[model samples]
Target: MDPVRRTPVVVTSALLTLLLTVLIVNLIQPVDAARAERTTAAGASSTSTVSVRRFPKAHHPSKSASSSSATKNQTKQQKPDPAATSAHPVDWLKPSQQVDYPDPAAHPGLSLEVSLQDQRVYVRDGSELLYTMYASTGMDDSTPRGSFRIQNERGDHFYNPREGMGARYYTSFLNHGVFLFHSVPTDSKGGYIKEEADMLGIRPGSHGCIRLTVPDARWIMQSVPTGTPVLVK
Candidate 1:
């Protein structure tokens, strides 16, 4: 009788042990799956951080680069245009109203050069140009082209009855009184002729003299010494 009862109790104990084993296995499997999910999520986050650090934002120009470009543009704008300056020349018709007299004592090599083509006179010390003056030479090549010494003949005023014209501040350079450096044409009453004065330095209008401005003629009459060499070309 005791053997049969012991067998039933043993069977019940075996069933209880099997149920507890299954419950523990189910709990451990869920915990391990959750841990694996957390590890995978952490690894993905680290990979995303590395990707962000590897590549930076797009590049932008610095302030110094922009300023250098601006400076280059300004330099180009300030440069002078040679063509523009050459197109516009000085107007010589207007009176200079200013004269810088030369000191023959300080400049012993000073001489005069006349340019018939340019209608200009250059006061030169050797090769150095000291001053420039506007002038009108004789028409039809009446004035001689050669080196001439300034003669001792000079006058304050004169008139030619045959030519019906006259001039002032005359200084003879050739033929004593034939070829002279004088002021613009004047009337018998000593008034300057406007039409002839306007032609000064522009074209040849004189009969046989080199015509100059009033101030220029006066300066030559008073300042230039005798025996000075004058070259006409």
Candidate 2:
């Protein structure tokens, strides 16, 4: 009610107002700073999420892509060297030539007919005449006639026991692989005896065995099985 009391009260009121104002400002500033930080963090998170969603992810190959890759790999594997293929050609004609022989009609026997008069041999699978080739039978009608069975065979350069001569592709139709059909006799060193090559099939020349060209001898060794019938006439 007095002037002094009123002044002190007014001062106290003013100070209280100032302090409240300061406290409110401090609280408001912290709240605004926190709001700004939260907004910035929210913006960064949104940008990160958008970037992740926009970018593409790695994927597996589709069916078409896989098929293309497989085709490329197969092409790489199957392409052969042209030079190598040209240099070493596979023999495709031999099998075609062999097809000339008629099927045996389930017969078990294969036969060889040695014609001393013609100086030739006829190959037969059962009743079918498959092939024929020249030969040199024994000198002086010494070839064995009638039927015989192939007992043994050999394919190597071997020396004849009597003359110490070498021969190739020896095949035995009689006398247990000793008396034989073989390539024209060679020297001891496996050199060809040209005189014997000239005499082949023109006249009888062997001691007691049949003689043939090297190819024919090898054919008989490979195609003619053991126990095949042989007939000389």
Which candidate number maximizes TM-score? 1
TM-score of candidate 2 relative to the true fold: 0.53
Query: For model 1, how does the per-residue alpha-carbon lDDT over 22-79 read when each residue is reduced to its tens digit?
Result: 9999999999999999999989998988887764532224566678889999999888
Model 2 off-target regions past 4 Å?
1-107
User: Candidate 1: how many backbone clashes?
Assistant: 0
What lDDT score is found at residue 90 in candidate 2? Answer: 16
Q: Quote the lDDT for 64 in model 2.
A: 67
Tell me each candidate's TM-score: 0.60, 0.53
lDDT of 2 by residue, 1-233 (tens): 67877998889999999999999999999999999999999999999998887665323356668899999999988899676564222121122134444333444666889999877788787777777766778898788788988776667668865686777878888878767878777888888677776666667888778878777777777667788888999
Q: What is the lDDT of residue 118 in candidate 1?
A: 78
Q: How accurate is candidate 2 locally (lDDT)?
A: 0.75
